[model samples]
Target: MKFVSWNVNGIRAAVKKGFMDYFNEVDADFFCIQESKCQAGQIELDLPGYEQYWNYAERKGYSGTAIFTKHTPLSVKYGVGENDSEEEGRIITLEYEKFYMVTVYTPNTKRDLSRLEGRLQWEDELKAYLKELDEVKPVIYCGDLNVAHTEIDLKNPKTNVGNAGFTDEERGRMTRLLKAGFTDTFRHLYPDTTDRYTWWSYMSKVRERNIGWRIDYFITSDCIVPAIEKAEIHDQVLGSDHCPILLEMKEF
Candidate 1:
């Protein structure tokens, strides 16, 4: 099975920049996207063999997520809880016979760190939610997690240490989540690979210089590690500030 995840930053904008062209070429078994920034009826994607599932935030043209899967899941769920007040449309879970697939657009702490507290709370809630799902079955969690997990995850970590995505609190949450049973598929395959990144800054010449952060990920239950055939960062593809990451499994 092949899975691909990309932030896209904004789906509509990405489409204009050749999103469909790459989408067709990749032919992923499951294609997950974050920050779609659009509601239902805003856009139409003519993908033939895929079941489309979208979760839109209450606020228009803001945070959202969608999944296009070639295989129809046994069940599909939106959000983390029944009474959960989260309205950003950040999460979607599709349950198959073999495993549960979850795509999340994790909340980001603003550049000024004003949202740091809320972001930390979100991390805790999401971690608990993932653990609950893992108890039932192995989980394939993928999306823009919004954090650079370690020094190697971002260029110039020293300069970015206290930044929104590289803050100690944020990175600690990611570490705890991985320790709880998930494996970052990319790092699992290439532990020492450097200068590989998924999201780049839009500032002048940043992307050209490869000054980026590995914020997007495909994390799976540790048991599924053996089934992972390949995990890659497609830094060459372009459409949004973020590029797509791929994971191929020998079998579910």
Candidate 2:
């Protein structure tokens, strides 16, 4: 099976910039996207042979997520609980016979870190939610988690240590999540690989320099680690600040 995840920044804008081209080229079994930034009835995508499920933020052109899958899910859920995220539409869960697939757009802590406390609470709730689902079935979680996990994840870790995406607090939540029986499929396959990233700053010439962070990921239950066939970063893809990531695994 092939899975693809990308934070398109804004789905509407991405479409104008050839989102459909990459979408068609990838032809993923499950195409997960974050930061859709669109509301219902705002945009229509012409995608045949795929089931499109979207969780739109209450506010227009804000945080949102979607998953285009070839398989019909047994159940589909939006959000985790009654909190800000429910309104922001940051998560979507599709339940299948074998596993539950979750796509998320984790709340960013803001450049000033003013939302740090709330963001941490979000992590705690997310961890609990993933664990609850894991108790019932293995999970395949993928999305733009909004954090650069380690020094190697970003270009200049020393200068970015306390920044929003590279903060210690944010990285710790990821650590806790992995320790709770999940494996980051990319890292699990290539622990020492460097200079590979999924998200880049839209700054002057950041992407041109390849100075980016591998914030987007494909993570699965620890038990499924052995099934990971290929985990890759499609850094060459255009249309968003983030690039697409691919994960090929044994059919479960």
Best by TM-score: 1
Estimate, for each residue in 125-231, the C-alpha lDDT of model 2 and write its tens digit: 98998999999998999999999998899999999889999898999999999999999999998899999999888899999999999899899999878889999
Global lDDT scores for all candidate models: 0.94, 0.92
lDDT per residue (tens digit) for residues 108-183 in model 1: 8999999999999989988898899899999999999999998889999999889999999999999999999999
Worst 10 residues of 1 by lDDT: 78-87
Candidate 1 ranges with C-alpha deviation above 4 Å = 83-85
Can you give the lDDT of residue 241 in candidate 2?
Answer: 95
Candidate 2 lDDT score at position 16:
94
- Name the 10 consecutive residues with the lowest summed lDDT in model 2: 78-87
- Residue 174's lDDT within candidate 1 is 98
Candidate closest to the true structure, highest lDDT? 1
Q: Provide C-alpha RMSD values for all models, in order.
A: 1.1, 1.4
